[model samples]
Target chain A: MSTVEAYARRTARRGWWRDGLEAAIYLVAAVGVAFFVASGGLLATAPVDHLYGLGRVAGIVAAVLVLSQITLISRAPYVERVVGHDRAAAVHMRLGKVAFVLMLVHVGLILAMSARYDGRSILAETTALWQLGWFIPAAQAGLGLFAIVVATSLVAIRSRWRYERWHAVHLLVYAAIALVVPHQFLEGSTFRSGGAAWWFWLALWALAVGSFVAFRIVRPLWLLGRHDLRVAAVETHPDGSTSVTMRGRGLDRLGARPGQFLLWRFLDRERWTQAHPWSLSRAPRPDALRITVKPSGDASAAVRGLEVGTRVLVEGPLGVFSEVARTASGCVLVASGIGITPVRAMLDEAHPACTVVWRVRSRAEAPLLDEVEALAAERGARLVILEGPRGPGWGTAAGETLAGIVPDVAARDVYVCGPVAWADAVERDARAAGVPAGAIHRERFGW
Target chain B: MRGSRAVLVAGGCAAIVGAGWAASPKELPTLDLVAPSSPAASATPGATPSPTPTVSATAGATGASSTYDGPVVTNARGDYQARITVADGQVTDVQAVVAGTPDAQSVQINAVAIPALRDEVLAAQTWDVAAVSGASFTSPAFTESLRGAFEEAGL
Candidate 1:
């Protein structure tokens, strides 16, 4: 085998193994804290002190969970491959909520425990805790930032807030985590110098935060420096959307599969801080990558105005919506509107029995319809186009369904991308039609 | 992957709680090195003998080697125990061992303050030594721990 091909194969195998090891590491770190507490005589404590001990243990694990949230969302490549980028993000959000709740319980029970012993009211005890040191108040502020992140992320609230505003709050989680560190090292008894438990906690924090710095910070800077990526051309598609083709050297070595995405930061004087993740609208090429934007929001709308030589800083070619994720003999590519970008790209590598299902409100709304159709024909995949508004479901018409457009969709790996609700609808129908849950891949492009 | 994840999570949580029960301290634990001595332990009416004992008053040159376990004195900083060795009516040595963990700052603070405080007490040949400025609390706690040691030594 060629050296490059051999290295790719080995890397792929290691990625799968790392997923299981990641789980094992997470489990061990959390259990190690519990083990630390148990060794200190958890049950031998007065029945009343047991609550306090449990809270202390909860605090340790909650700290782990907080760090884990960062690790998962850092866009670490190995994790992205195992669960896919979208699922990693979804799990990141879910774990954030759980960690926050556990922390609240930890703080509440610890305060209550103190009150019981000090013979003071809970409120008075809380005041005492705040007075203990700068660490307690700092930790409280950290938890408060976490609350803001969780509050703004609520579905009802997130709809009203722009992605930039919500995301700005979301980024405070890093600061929240930093602010909480002193209390763990200074005040948390388990981390104090009695045993090796302190080292265990330190290692967990190092692994999680170190990965964040390496992948999110260092890797992006390296990619931007190495590739020297810039906009080679920006074309207004026949539809209202715009397509940006970026040029950089050695793009082929990026290992970006078709249907993957790049977190694109168009370094314009205006809105430079906003990064919109755009998927490849065409198969990844050797010296260039392309993304189609629909002008739907502030960031997307600004893409139409990007100068030809605009510098583009990218964090990925992330996500796993490709043929490598395929688990069936044939594949079904489903998309609506701009969602067709990934579907069009993936069609470049479609199998002989593959099928394409496109949903658009009208013919003009489909930007790359001609290219999609041509690709399908070349690969001998059936091309089914459905025009008109989506119905009660993700249907192209009032009563149309997946089985109607692609008769063998249930027998193939179905990749769906579009609006969040539309993609979810597709997944729901695919499952209802007896497709195994694992065979359906969808990316929810939401905050 | 999902099956494996489910198993890992369930087993992990079970292991945490199960190990928690297994590792907990036994009743009335031995506490070999030290325990965080409560304020109640020090404040009790007669737990400790009066500070003005005869051992410190006795004149020079006793040939016996004596070992004393000082009271585990806890302050805002944490707990500590000072082992005091006296020979020929001089305060031969004072070593303070912290009960729990001393954080980095405390470690540094105590590192400077403990030895100086010990020397001052040893030079004065008494427990009424002056406190160090940056380590006022530790100075007092160290003295208290030392006094507990002295009381055990009948001084």
Candidate 2:
């Protein structure tokens, strides 16, 4: 192996192990913080009933922090470096799923406990206390929105349709996180009393705001200052999508891989100052990097209009969906809709030992199908197209369902992208067919 | 410094004006002729020949009446009934009798200021004597019922 490839392998291996350990440590810290805060005896000699109420509120706040910590840590700059991009991302996505579950429990317990004193149905009482009531529903809505994003980004969901579109929609997770803030402040009893509660809340707010600043603003600005990549070429596909090729002085030295995405902040007069994640469709070549962005959202739509020489800020080489990890003897690649962007990049590298399963609603909707098929043919990997609905008779033609078609699916590692639900379904199906949980990997395109 | 001096002069003038205001009685509706009845006058009966009970010597020294009096009657069963009467805002007589037991003394007030006192007590606006201890039920009820009758009699 080349020195670069060896370095990449070492980094990937260390990251895989460290990511699990870091996540575990963070989990313990989060739970410990919650338990300590909930043991309200340290504060005051309150009436037993009042103490119980106070303890319950403290527990809720702690739980929220635990979740917020998971989200924040998964996206932390240092943590990302240690875990590498894609492995860090996998941890981030799984933690986010767990956080949503915790958030649900926190909100439910809060409403139920609050109902005891208010002497009305939880809904009715909350409505009467308008400010407090808003938090419960808002938190619920935020969790629901997050769940939708996660569900759609699942492997099975991404294997079906436009991966780019689902990826763009998945950015709503940030908005969901933002929505949870007000509920924490308004309804949280801990916030009412100052001192420890005040500091705790302030710390949480700072962490959340700090993460946003780091991810959305600070990191982008830092990247812009250090690396100046200009648009080298803009290739428009027949499917109303365009790819912007960025070339810089030291693009290859940045050590980005195919299938790894970057937060592209274009510096055109019209589309400047907006950051969006785009998959690096082509592998890192010296002085040149290519990101194929489908004309889906505000940022991507402007990619086609960018001047050839316009400067752009690239914040990543983020995401763990790259082929830096162990290469299986046989692999099944699933792409739903626009989720094929990353898969296409992976296939471009030519892992001939892999089997590509491209799922789409209609043959016409598959934008990169020809290129994907051509790559598959060139690499000598088996290509299977599961067209239309796979109903009760779905598995008959393929001799089994998508899961069954790949009998070695359990043995082979799987990478999924697209809508959260698609990923979830695919992961669920894959696991059911005896796929080891660790082998079935996924990268969520969520903000 | 000038502002401070101005404030100090203004404060001095205000203090002088306050002193003058404090010195003046300022007109108030006179209740000098109608004085508060004395406890002693109310306790005695026919102590003076005047229709209004004589102001007690001690009351005059204190600038207020010392006693109050009304009426007293006896029932056929020898029960004592002290019917206290008042006229022209002064207690006139308090006739008392003991019919059977010394402990069971029945007191009544059919007097001028006494009726107002009774009205005030029964309305629970005030208690003339700190509510009678150990006889809370009987004492207040008896006093309150008599006060009601006194108010009806307009004396």
Q: How does chain A of every candidate compare to the true chain A by TM-score?
A: 0.92, 0.63
Q: Give fnat, all candidates.
A: 0.38, 0.00
Off by over 4 Å in 2: A1-46, A49-60, A63-74, A77-215, A295-302, A324-327, A361-365, A386-400, A403-405, B1-155
DockQ, all candidates in order: 0.23, 0.01
How close is every model to the real structure, measured as TM-score?
0.79, 0.50
lDDT of each: 0.73, 0.55
lDDT (10s digit) by residue, model 1, range A1-447: 664455456445645665564676467655766655554625333466667766876787788777777788878886777767887888777877888888899988887766665455888766666645788889989989888878878853546778887788788977888889989877775565546677777887898888889988798889888888899998998888988899998888878989989888878798568778889999988889998988887888778778888888888778878766766677788888889998888888877787788888998989787898889889898888888886778875576788877777788788998888788888899998878876788877874
Clashing residue pairs, candidate 1? A38-B23, A38-B24, A39-B23, A41-B24, A41-B25, A42-B24
The per-prediction CA RMSD against the true structure, in angstroms, equals 6.9, 22.7
Q: For candidate 1 chain B, which ten residues in a row score worst on lDDT?
A: B45-54
